[model samples]
Target: MSLDMSLEIEGEIPDWEALDNAIRSVGVINYEIDRDYVFQGAFKKSDGYFWLSKRSEAQRKTVIAEGNHGCSFCVYNAIVFRINNFYYDDFVEDMNSFLKKLTSLSSMQFVLSFQYEDVYAVRNKRGFEFFWDQPR
Candidate 1:
């Protein structure tokens, strides 16, 4: 299952490399094309992108997305914030601001992501915006 924030920026992401580098301290930006080569007889995956934070505890954070060369829907290409944990907050926060900073240049929209944790029959809502400082 793929998931992330509901907000995102589309079109040419300015200074994409620099932006990727800036967030390295939190997580890594992985373009699908860079890895996962197709077998000689297999078909190559289309252009898509996404990233994940190294696992620290029992869980890991990720954003399965697409860029200009990809279709709009795949994973939660529209990253919102947080999964079911708070430790992943910083990365979410940083990306939030990063996208916010680019709002003027790219076409992006932040939408509400409904999340819930199930404890048997009860569902606990743990919704909040998570973030980190963007490297200067």
Candidate 2:
């Protein structure tokens, strides 16, 4: 089974080296660098999996209005990961670990959005997806 995963992080500009280190720690099959984004190669266990990481700066005023909840100073981060046949438990565990590491480094709440595709399903509709908004 192959799964595609994308991870986005917003808030607090990350040091490229630090970010790279954190991702490399995942022990994925392959990875590529493109500007501020990183793309990972497919995993045999996750043949159809695709992962993406991206970052964006937030508006300063939105930060002030939201107070600490606003990562205005921190870049707007978002991650989207798509999984094909992997089990939910395994995926969640991996994501939890990644989120923990990100939070520790930024010292600010991080938001997460997860989406999954059903390769076996007959419907063409999008797969399962979930999201959580974190505090600043």
Candidate 3:
């Protein structure tokens, strides 16, 4: 199955270099980063998952509000991680593990979304825009 993973980070990481290092440490194939989000390209692994790590208070608030109230900020962040196919249970487990590791090292609160493929910004009737793709 094809798996697309998106990781969100708020604030600056003192060890920003570790971001790529951590992902590499996971041994996944086709990993790519664009701005603040990291996308692990489609993988054939049994299971897959993505982590949204919030390093700042603003980022944490965004996650909580989006999760609890469908906040626009959350909707925008959701656009980056889109997959074209369904995943198996193993994918979910692996994703959770990845998230756990990121949070443990970064001290950032994270939210986990499993087997989600629909891109929110494009699909939403409201035409929400993703943070990364916004015109400068």
Q: What TM-score, computed on C-alpha atoms, does each candidate reach? A: 0.29, 0.48, 0.44
Q: Scored by Cα lDDT, where does model 3 land?
A: 0.39
Per-residue lDDT value at 23 in model 2: 49
Candidate 1 residue-wise lDDT, 75-120, digit = tens? 2222233333333444345445444444333333222232211100
Give the number of the best model, judged by TM-score: 2
- Model 3, C-alpha of 1: deviation from truth (Å): 13
Of 1 and 2, the candidate ahead on lDDT is 2
Q: What is the C-alpha RMSD of each candidate to the true structure, in Å?
A: 14.7, 10.5, 11.3
- Candidate 3 residue-wise lDDT, 1-136, digit = tens: 5555444333344234554455555556656666666544433364243333334445443433222213233322331243434555555444444444554465433233323322211112232233222211
Q: Which candidate, 2 or 3, has the higher TM-score?
A: 2
Q: Which stretches of candidate 1 lie over 4 Å from their true place?
A: 1-4, 8-27, 33-86, 110-112, 115-136
For residues 1-136, could you state the per-residue lDDT of candidate 2 as single tens digits?
Answer: 4343433333445444554554455444666656745655533333334455443333322222222221223434434556544455555555544454544454333333223222111100222223322312
Residue 104, model 3: Cα distance from true site in angstroms: 2.5
lDDT, model 1: 0.29
What is the lDDT ranking, best to worst? 2, 3, 1
Superposition error at 30 for model 2 (Å) = 1.9
Please report the TM-score between candidate 1 and the true structure.
Answer: 0.29
Q: Give candidate 1's error at residue 77 in angstroms.
A: 6.9
